[model samples]
Target: MISKIELLNEIGIALSAEKNSQKVLELILDGAKKLTNADGGSLYTLNDKDELVFEIVSTDSLDIHMGGTTGQSIDFPPLPLHIEGHDNLSMVVTSAVLNDNTINIHDAYHADGFDFSGTRKFDENTGYRTKSLLTIPMKNHKADIIGVLQLINSTSIDTGVVVDFSSEDQKLAESLASQAAVALTNKKLIDEQKALFEAFIKLIATAIDEKSPYTGGHCKRLPELTMMIADACDKDDAGALKDFKMTEKDRYELMIAGWLHDCGKVTTPEYVIDKSTKLETIYDRINTVNARFEVLKRDAKISMLEKQMTARETADEQAFKDAERDYEALIEKLNDDKEFISVANVGGEYMAEDKQERVREIAKYKIDDCEEERCNFFNEDEIQNLTIAKGTLTNEERQVINNHIVVTIKMLDQLPFPKHLENVPEYAGGHHERMDGKGYPKGLTRDQMSWPARMMGIADIFEALTARDRPYKDGKKLSVCLDILGKMRLDNHIDPEIFDVFVREKVYMEYASEFLTPDQIDEVDHSKIPGFSGD
Candidate 1:
């Protein structure tokens, strides 16, 4: 008979490791098989619908493999549980899953005439005789059945001395099953939490999309690409990510940070967020430049006609035709490239009035009626909120865009988190803050931030600079993007020491390897990237 002390010792050993439900099951099955002097075993876990699902102790040798899922809605058939005693093992262990239902069976297989003919694998592989069996139902603290564990052919396992299933065998199997249930339950809870998190992200992204047609789904791609970058970061800096040791609390914090990172976008004005041109609010006024070209054309035509009339007085027709053709060619040249549109505003930085007025005059003839209406149709409150000026936005509009960090802090503050999640608010909020005081919304320097916050800061910026999904910008090639970030490091906008780690780790290249498409990666010159080498 296996002693209680040995069983408890093994249980403590199995549960000490972090996460992954399957390892715990393998431990239970292996431990029970050894304790009961049995040849082989399997663990069956019950799902939400009360359907059984096999966890581990598959058809091969029963060593533990972790992180596998027997989750969702898979079906598991019941084994022909041997009933040898007065008590019902299934009913008792139903408590493992159900939590309140417990059956304390003592001699689980004794008198119910348990059948062996229905058995499969243990005989198929071993080619050995199988006669006796012990079965026990797994129960949680609440007495619900999480799983059923069965030990086949109890005997002198090493010496091949055949023996019948003992009362000891039944007790041991029941104990192991109970432990397996708890592992299964925890795994299920984690899955449910993950699903809820994904749903919440979709909801928030949709709300951001609703604010402007131009940024219809910008926020949604940020988190996806953030995760993809994180994965690359992990691979490139596996040693570094491991140094973080990322506790369960750390994982939860990173998750919240990713979703809430762009909360600042909420405060940014839709027009500024969707601005398609340098001096754009209502009209681009590009047509003004075209109008100036048209006036030039008119002047050219008038001169040519006068010259033609004068020439007729002198009897010369070819010269007037040549002048007409030259004017058309001049207009065509002005039309191409259209003088790379520039506009002047009075609020933040004023554009030169002469240049501004000259462009405005050219646009006069091409101005559509709707263009005027959209220009003047500004909402008093929204305009006040946006702080847009004639030439550029007031300093206030820039602050509003930057206040997305503030919005993130405010929104995350409202979530009621479980214990130790207090840091979630700070970590998520601090993502945009520079290592130096250059970042907005509380420019607390390096010592004030946690390692997790620093990692997040790096992740957020790297994703943004390389990201292609923003309404106003195209994604940069890896070399150009990293060069900018590297310069920022030099400027104290980012951590200089961390930048070294970033280069040595080749974090950007590894990230781009996965994040950038085949054509996208191919477009960049590898050697030019600030921190990467061709070798």
Candidate 2:
């Protein structure tokens, strides 16, 4: 009794509003089956294999349903559009698609020209009757057949008996198919575009990672760790993070932010990121320093031999003994100085004032006619490197490294992210910030940052601490890393509440069990942790 105009309008509205393509396909078939009072219905889409694949199947009388939103698999083989290079239009659905027209049969048992043996076999096997049928070709806006809509066994509303599909039924189905085609086409395009955008973002992250072997897995690992922590926070219902929650959209936004958090590293110089030693540039200049130590040792030996000759020439036995003692002392001093310089070259947490003074004192020693002229034992640049207060980088190089967060913010701020992902720039850029307002870039405090951003901050720090791939230091054991993180929590460098949840939930251990080496996985005592309470 429903008017065709009203039904078509309703179908258009539903199809347009649907976001999930699978659900949309099911809706189309359901609507068709309802309008015609069909006992069974199915939907098929063309796969890349050039076959009509069964997407959804529904039959009310036999209580059979599969595929689509039902999540049941359709074990039936695909209907081939072409077999052995010929258009296989023998099947009713295939004929409708090939001809781009609706095929309405009063009864499949008496229908001519098209093969219904499969239908007959299905009826025989299931003891079900297949009578009235309507097969409609689904064509998109491009006038290309994308799928087919087939309804079986139209029944009377008054008696619930099998009947032929009316002309009105055919018209209603074709109209519904048209609306469905447009909906499907739009959804496909949207999904394709989303996939391309994500791929491009990951590609940028990959390129940044490729710039330095020391940080090879950093960009990838940070996002994973970020999500792990975020998920933990979102799922926590018993702590400071109990109220924290994230929808699928929020998770997706955070994922994109995580991948792009270090995108600015692409602009960072590789030498700084991959600097393996204090004096490294094109190569480790520690070798040059080693050569200088050799020359100094050679000069010391020459001086001792000259003094020995003098003592022997004058028959000064006591003087010979003194000369021998001085020679031994000089060799010992030179060896100690060389060892000190070698250790300094590798860089560490701190370089003491005394170490810097010794480097200066060693630089005063001259190597005559070395590389065509007399040169200091250590050049000015070498002296600068040896005196670096901490780590492999000089103060200026550390500044350059810190500027990556600023650059990350600038780059992400330029992007036109959709409303759902509008916070990505802030979330990504805030990873370097601290809870106590002491961190870099904008110096956002705990209150200033979002929960997801705080989650990312923990992820970034924890991953860096546990990472075995850094050039400067071995990955810390789980207990040692947790001890450091606990201290960071007490110091307010990271969010205390988030860290509490992280510990209570054992997120770090879960992560360690996956990414950390076997040696790094060790027992952790909560009481020894700097700021830990109990689980």
- Candidate 1, residue 322: lDDT: 74
Global lDDT of model 1 = 0.58
**How many pairs of residues collide in model 1?**
30
RMSD from true fold, candidate 1: 8.1
- State every prediction's TM-score relative to the real structure: 0.66, 0.95
Clashing pairs in 2: none
Q: For residues 338-453, could you state the per-residue lDDT of candidate 2 as single tens digits?
A: 89888988887688899899889999988865456887777788888889987889888899999999899999889898998999999999998999999988988899999989
The number of clashing residue pairs in each candidate reads 30, 0
TM-score of decoy 1: 0.66
Query: Deviation in angstroms for 474 in model 2?
Result: 1.2
Best by lDDT: 2
Model 1 agreement with the true structure over 1-535: per-residue lDDT tens digits: 4365587567746754536566566677777777777766556666655555666543223332322353433244543223353222343233233333223222334424322333435356556544565556676667666577756666665587657666656665665666666666666677688678768866776777678665565566445544444444454443444454455565655666667667657667787666554445566433543464565566567877787788778776777677677767766754542552322222222344565444444343332233343232222332332233332444655666677788888888898866656787787788778877767688878778866566667766777666665544567766667777767766677655455556655666677776765544544443554543333
Q: lDDT for model 2, please.
A: 0.89
